[model samples]
Target: MTVPTLTLNDGKTIPQLGFGVFKVDPEETERIVTDALEVGYRHIDTAAVYGNEEGVGRAIAKSGIARDELFVTTKLWNDRHGADESKRALGESLEKLGLDHVDLYLIHWPTPENNNSVETWEAFPSYRDQGLTTSIGVSNFDHRYLPQILDTGIIPAVDQIECHPQFQQIETRPLLTEHDIKVEAWGPLGQGKVDYADTVIGEIASAHGKSWAQTIIRWHLQRGHVVFPKSNNRDRMAQNFDVFDFELTTAEVAAIDGLENGGRVSGDPAEVN
Candidate 1:
């Protein structure tokens, strides 16, 4: 199965359908990650805040997969957003993952409320130069916050955000496209907040002989968004990656787009931070 790829701003290619370890328990990380690897997931997303880097590292080592075959992403957390701390936090993540370099490193949140986002954005590029991380980007950043970072003359390779049918990020999409920043969907399935078996998605799934999870993921892919759906359940992890076989029609895609309600299930980064 050949997974599709998205070219980053820096010209790096990322698997469009990757595996994510957002809430996977630390203790079960090794086994679950090992299973994901066995199931054919070459890209893995983790964060310093997730506290499961060690287990991910152990799984990668035990899987015996060649290092170049994997694409690993880790992030810098809110509290460690400044230049010096951002650099140190990435180093710590590298040490924990037991890898010399991460395929991508992200700013977990703008945390503008913390009043240190600028300082942190200023420091992100040094990672690419130092060879600590192959690419650098941001998460939970909106149209407002994104320009602030880009105005610094450094464009992020990707901008990951909470994107699903309910929260399509209508306004932010153009800004990202205009700047050549690839948009990645985090919480692609809405963190399971929206019922996957709901009528609309279910109907689409049944028509295509695909799972609702696969249908939603395909919607994101057709819209040119990179996605990583998290699932510790072995079968579902495999199911999520099974979306490469089908494609949604223009009307079917529009129907899904019409489901957007401007609702967000996750906390607003601007407010939370």
Candidate 2:
């Protein structure tokens, strides 16, 4: 169960497969996160807006896992995209997570309507300089906004985006690749919006003797994207992590790629503000 790591632009490495706590209940976050840790997940992704950083921190402390052995990620919320606001935001998130520094910090969304993402992105380097975060990136950002961020001479290490078979983000992938920025796929299973059970993916799963969810996760891994599929049930969490044994053939990956329909199940990056 050794998870592979991707090298970031800043020379840091991140676990390719991790656990994400997006909508998990705050009260149960500790228990859930604890279960994930026990199931062999070393990378944990949380956000200030998730309101569960305290619980995640509790689980980390209780596990007694050496801080250096784990990778933690949190995001600055949209409202904090003002001068020096992200600085305060990351400090608070660190406080909640009971950590002096996080492995990675991100701008949660572009929020273009606010017209301040560039200003927000400009300050990210300073956070890294201050040792508040080791790597800085953005989420839910598309080409429209990324160019401006790039113009600031700070290329993001990764762009956490909603990516699945149905919405492969064809328009944005090239841009990210061109910049050598890793694509961290959130909602890798389409957030339950696309039924993998009845599609070619299910057939592929049957052939590989794996679950539909596992098959999709394999697809993501095979495609070289960093992914954190969320699951509260320990068994399912383990199942998701059990993808390393099998490999999807090139044709099989092409079959999954065919499932792309150019649709997004979540917020439009340009409109999420």
Candidate 3:
């Protein structure tokens, strides 16, 4: 099936639905990534800190898919939160991914302790200018740093935040919308922390004749945000990729939205930074 795509602020496009490798075993990355690729997923999300870029690279190389046809994304870790370290981190990530350039790169965190996100994000342009990364963005950045990063007049192409129905970015999404930055949901399924099976999400999934995971993924897609649902299971990976065939209704989307209770499964931007 053909996955839908979203146009970034920079005029570059990304698949709205992609596969992720958050906690996958490094030894199993190649096998799992290859599974995802064979399931017709062209977009793969990884990070240097994930310790699986090399395995992702190996799967791509082994797949024989042309470079331009795939969308690969990696990030700069929090410790690499500086101008110089940002540049070096991307270079190392590229080397590990076995690619001369990545489709997208992001600042992993705002690094609130040092408040150095602005300084680190400032170096993204050099990578774009150097042709090391086609597009650049940030992750886990809340309203606090959005303006600071944009004050430099360098708006990111996207901002990948931890957005799930339970913890929707009621505040951050609008700021990104105003700035033309795409919203990419990192844990679209709540890293399995979300109990969709016995909740309203489960009812929606039943109506659509789909799994809870597929229904939630459809929610993100219909909302016009980008999402990456990670799964090492081949069937589950295909299930996540098969969301394009149906669309959620307005009330269904709103019901899912109502499930929000200010819950967040991962590090909060306010506390983590």
Candidate 4:
């Protein structure tokens, strides 16, 4: 299956659907990542905090896939949110990933309470120029914080966040669009919290003869958002990638959109630090 790519502000392209290793055990990372790549996933999202970059690197190296054929993304952790530290942290991530450069690098979370996000964001352009990262963006950013960064006239290529049907992030979407930042969903499956067997998603899945996961992923795709659903299970990983065949109708899309409760399953970025 061919995954579509989103063009970044820096003129780079990223696969719309990616594989995420957020909580995969370090020991299991290589095996799972290898399975994902074998199943046709070209994008892999890891972070320094995930503690699995080394495993991801090993898997990619052993897979025999050319480095240029894969899209790798790593993030700068909150504590490492400073000018010099951001650059150094990315270097550390690159070393762990066993690559000289990454396709995309993101500020994991904008810890506004700590008052360091602005300084860290300011440091991103230098990283891009240094050739350490092809594109730079932010994660867990909202309407309030996004403007702060964009006001500097530096439009981030993408904004990765906790977006699922339950936590649609409607208010933040326009802001990202206004700044030409592509919205990438982090916890697209609600971290497995929401019942995929629910009537809404299930009914749509039945109509399309696809799994609920596939239905939800199709929803994200139809809406033009980048989505990465995390799973260590090989079959489920393949199932997540099998979303290119069907399209959800407008009414079905509305029903899924109506599931939004403005709830977020992950820790609030404002309080993470």
State the lDDT of candidate 3 residue by residue for 1-273, as single tens digits: 778788888999998888999999999999999999999999999998899999999999999999988999999988888899888889899999999999999998887888888888888899999999999999888787677888989999999998889888887778888988988998999999867789999989989999999999999988888898999899999888888778898999999999888888888777774
lDDT of each: 0.90, 0.93, 0.90, 0.90
lDDT, candidate 2, 1-273, per-residue tens: 789999988899999999999999999999999999999999999999999999999999999999999999999999998758889988899999999999999999999889998888889988999999999999988877788888888999999999999888888888899889999999998887788889999999999999999999999999999999999889999999999999999999999999998888889887788
**Model 2 poorest 10 in a row by lDDT:** 142-151
Candidate 3 residue spans exceeding 4 A from truth: none
Q: CA lDDT of 143 in candidate 1?
A: 83
Model 4: residues with Cα > 4 Å off, grouped in runs = none
TM-score of 1: 0.98
**Highest lDDT scorer:** 2
Q: If scored against the real structure, what TM-score would every candidate get?
A: 0.98, 0.99, 0.98, 0.98
Off by over 4 Å in 2: none
User: Cα RMSDs of all predictions?
Assistant: 1.0, 0.7, 1.0, 1.0
Question: By summed lDDT, which 10 consecutive residues of candidate 4 come out lowest?
Answer: 190-199
Best model per TM-score: 2
